[model samples]
Target: MVDVSAITYDALRVAAEHVLAKVREGEELGTEDIFILYLGTIVNELRDVRSEVARLEDKIDKTSQRIDETNKRIDELAKSLSARIDDTNKRMDETAKSLSARIDETNKRIDETNRRIDEVVKSLSARVDDLAKRIDALQTTLLEIQKLLIELVRSRQ
Candidate 1:
């Protein structure tokens, strides 16, 4: 039961070289040497797998960070748009109030002008009535003077 993690690359290389030399010299491989070589191959494959897993984990961490940053920016933009909408609503309300006040003022002025026109019409009607009475009195006086002249002319002849 050798610790697989504890075996170094140098040690594995030396073992492989020794095995190779023994084979070349026409010697038989012991069971222990074959087991060590098999363990070395397994350790090397496991190291490669671990390195690939670490690379994938690093990539996943970077993608997660980018997603978080994008979410933050989206939240900030939404808040800004909300603030702008609120400001526009306030401005529109103020403008509506201003226009309403101006309309009220204009109505008041129109009502005042109508009242002045009514007063002028009433005064003119009264003056026209007085002039009509004076004209009737003058016509009656002229008719009486004409009758007197006609009677005096007949008595003289």
Candidate 2:
């Protein structure tokens, strides 16, 4: 019997081939062969899931970068506006109406930036939470599969 503990993809493939050869010779598949077949199928599914996780991770990274960039731009704009307000204050002879208008516009921009930031934060948090759950699920599935395979291997021993 093949050592299930030492099983790798290549080894499993060879074992499968051997089992098939036995079948062709009108022999029944061994217990190890049955377990290997089941694991092979699960491995294929896991491969696909792993690829999807990678793709999502990349997307999250890009999105996070964009959010950070946007937040930085908003901060810079707020700083610039504050500077402009200070300059406006220094020139008291300037029209009061114009100063008022500028302050109002700055407030509006600040409010909008804050709103956008909140939205981005919420979106990022939701995405992270979703990813965490998916990762947890994946981990659980992998552990469960490992347990089953280990049990099968141990049973043979």
Candidate 3:
């Protein structure tokens, strides 16, 4: 790499020395030499400014690359999150379906149990009614037998 600072420093030092030497000799500097010397300092300052600008541009480029990398990572994270959400949704749907099927089966079992209970109740009711009718007929027969016994006792006396 070219060392612009070193070159500019050397040029400035040489011009200053030459001017000092001419002044010590009691000689007047030519107008062209003074102009050239003055312009040399200006050119060196411009070179330094250009070097600073290049360094700043390089920093900007690096910063931009870092930002792009960050964006890429963010995009990847978003996609990963989206995929996870979709998977969770699918699992929830499956669970709901399973729960619904189980609920349907439980309802069917409950309905069957209710039907059996009704049938049992109807059979017990019929048995109770039959027992009541048989008891009533037995009571009437006993009353008729008691009347016959009383008539026999009165004739004997």
Error (Å) of candidate 2 at residue 82 is 1.6
For residues 26-136, could you state the per-residue lDDT of candidate 2 as single tens digits? 987778878877877787788899899999999999999999999999999999999999998877746787889999999999999999999999999999999999999
Best by TM-score: 3
Error at 44, model 3, angstroms: 3.9
Q: Residue 63 in candidate 2 has what lDDT?
A: 100
Error (Å) of candidate 3 at residue 8 is: 16
User: Residue 98 CA error for candidate 1 (Å)?
Assistant: 2.0
Q: Flag the better candidate by TM-score, 1 or 3.
A: 3
Q: Between 2 and 3, whose TM-score is larger?
A: 3
Task: Report how far residue 5 has shifted in candidate 3, in Å.
Answer: 19
Per-residue lDDT for 1-157 in model 1, tens only? 8776466766877887888788789999999788877877887898899999999999999999999999999999999999999999999999999999999999999999999999999998888888888888778887887888889899898
Instruction: Give the Cα error of residue 87 in candidate 1, in Å.
Output: 1.9
What's the lDDT for all of these models?
0.88, 0.89, 0.89
Q: Which stretches of candidate 1 lie over 4 Å from their true place?
A: 1-54, 136-157
List residue ranges in candidate 2 displaced over 4 A.
1-7, 20-27, 93-157
